[model samples]
Target: MIETEAWVLYERSGGSESALDSDDFRRETFAFPGPAGDELLVEPLFGSWEGNMTHSLQRRPIDICKQRGERRVVIGNGSVLRVLRAGADVRGIHEGDVGILHGGHVQDEFGYTVLVQGYDAPGTVGVLAKRTKIAARNFLPLPLESHHRLEQWAAFSVRYLTAWSNYHLALGAYRLQVNEPLDPAPFVLGWGGGSTLAALDLARRAGCRAAMVSGSPQRLAELARMGIVGIDRRAFAGLEFDEGRYASDPEYHAAYRAAERAFLAAVHDWTGGRGAAIVFDYIGAPVFRASVKALGRQGVLATAGWLLGMQTTVNRAIECIGRHVHVHSHYIRRADSPKAMRYAEREGWMPQVSEIYSWEEIGGLARAAAAGRLRSYFPVYRVNPV
Candidate 1:
């Protein structure tokens, strides 16, 4: 057994509303019990949190683990895991190989244990093993040493996987499910995040048109450079809409609804007044409502996260009769990661990182992220060098 230290987050049982208040973290060294069977011992290299729903402990607004912690070891978008040691029986993995850590569960038939985190069992080193199966699989291998920054590989791991699954599995498959052919279609990408970038790339690959809505001018500019139509939601941050029917305060909810309307208008114009074939939404509530409204007949609206709040109020009438829109909860399956990686390798895809932090700065980064002061497109943490 090799001894090593890991920083872990401990969410106290039954506690406060704020994750920062209720949770505590510590660094502890424990033995790296050698892989039992097909297990592969891995050290996390680069990671970044989505800061949305899945990363939240008690539905906290911001994600704390993007900066630090080991819970849901494979949950982040750009989290990269390096194989440190491999069990004798392990195949398709080596000591120096790199792969993505995914949040999918291994089936009982596969005989691979899915380790969520070691937080539940103190003093025990949690080992998550990856294995190849006939059916569902999670781990995706990357190109060997050809990549420059480790952070780029990490971001490519999940964000692209998510975008691919959203378009291919969710929307494309949904179209097939309805006895329709999978074809290139217009897409409305809400919130210019990492996944949105990947979706744009997927749209380009599929020969589809895409428009984006974002508050960040930098992200908008980036999308524009890719020939994507972008609508700056910041402009509508103060516009009044519906006579303030959905108004919450002086310039909060009302402004948000106005932005949604503006985004929908842009989508309509971009799609030639036919709306979009698909709308990918990460920001919940009003954006979701807008996505539903902007969908053309038989369109699909796939959502993955709830950055604002999960509870949303959309027009029940449209859901009932106006449109045949399909609203799907988008979660990337284990099988989707490898497919996305294969496509990315062919296209030479990589994530754009805004900040890179050393493994040592995790604590301070977590504090800043908790305070909502951290501004980043993607924050990558380098744990160990190759």
Candidate 2:
């Protein structure tokens, strides 16, 4: 049978008022009592209660192993395993458990500790006992080391969990509140290489039945392979320029004006009478401004790249009042998750990789990317096979 314990570490004070009024003493205390406005009364000025609670609870696994005279104690879950590994004279738990600890067995407030029983599969660990109020189940009843490796592991784990949780929450907000079903399809203006594809994929996933517009036919063809319909702009023939006349000369000036007019006319014709629902602009500020002008009421222009340039001067007050179009900037930092990437690949949303290279090839790969010779559809990974 698996065993566990829970314990609370409280700071010592001389008298009743000493306990109640001494801020320094209360500051070290992990958990405290409160009533309404008194909720703010027992705030710990030193550290978090959750950290203290986790530190206190970790002792249970260690103590239980020692008392039972067992050479090793196995802690399931990555965080607990990391903690167990850091403590001296304790045998660290390995992943490969399957039994889950019943929820009601422990207090739900802190909701951290769980006892492992055994394994269900090769790598998966199982929980046996979970969420217990019994103090005896708590183990390793000692103060954590000042520069504890376990604390570092815990901090890193919490950081990732917090980021992932925030991302999901934002996605939830989009689904429930912000997102609306778009109709008549949207005209997506794509630029650059990688981010453009990503935006197109996102719009398609968001149920925007749209046609993508790209400067490169090669990129448009790549999108087409992914079942995304595209309008290729590279197909348009270039107008002949009157090179004999300078910009100061009337003929050259007239030619430049005609070119601008021709470009705007092409854009207007391509968009049809109804304005675009969304414009995925990654080009320069001039293109972005033009995209904003082309949007109908309630239309959105999402910019993911500023590689061409960033500074765009605008009469914001006038634009906001007249256009009623929303301009948003999207900066996506690639999530460092093998699981998420694998899922994307399995779902057929992410393109299959064509090659895997050694670390030595990284510089060459960068040059290839700069030269635009690389397809940019696949994720590149530098693997050390050794």
CA error at residue 324 for candidate 1, angstroms: 3.6
TM-score of each: 0.77, 0.44
Candidate lDDT (C-alpha), each: 0.57, 0.35
Which residue pairs clash within candidate 1?
78-154
lDDT of 1 by residue, 1-386 (tens): 65566554553444445545423644455444455566666776676655532334333643334333433221223356777667677677777777776644332444322322321212223221121111113446666665446677776655666677666644554465344344445554555366766776677666677777777777778878877777787766643233336554656665666677776677777787876767777666645666677777666777655555567666667765744455544446665466666666667766777788776776666666666656665666666665
Error of 1 at 168 (Å): 0.8
- Which regions of candidate 2 deviate over 4 angstroms? 1-187, 235-271, 322-346, 355-357, 370-379
**CA error at residue 343 for candidate 1, angstroms:** 1.1
Question: What are the per-residue Cα lDDT tens digits for candidate 2 across 1-386?
Answer: 22332111222223322111222111111221221221111100011011112221223112333333432322222122211111122233122211111111123244422322221111111111121111112221212332222222222222222222233333333334235453424554444444455556655664554556665666677678876666655443232233334345886656555654554465567667555555656554545555566555455555533434456655677556644444442211223232323333344333333454333453344334333355444323322111
Clashes of 1: 1
Error of 2 at 117 (Å): 38
Q: Please state the error at residue 92 of candidate 2 in Å.
A: 13
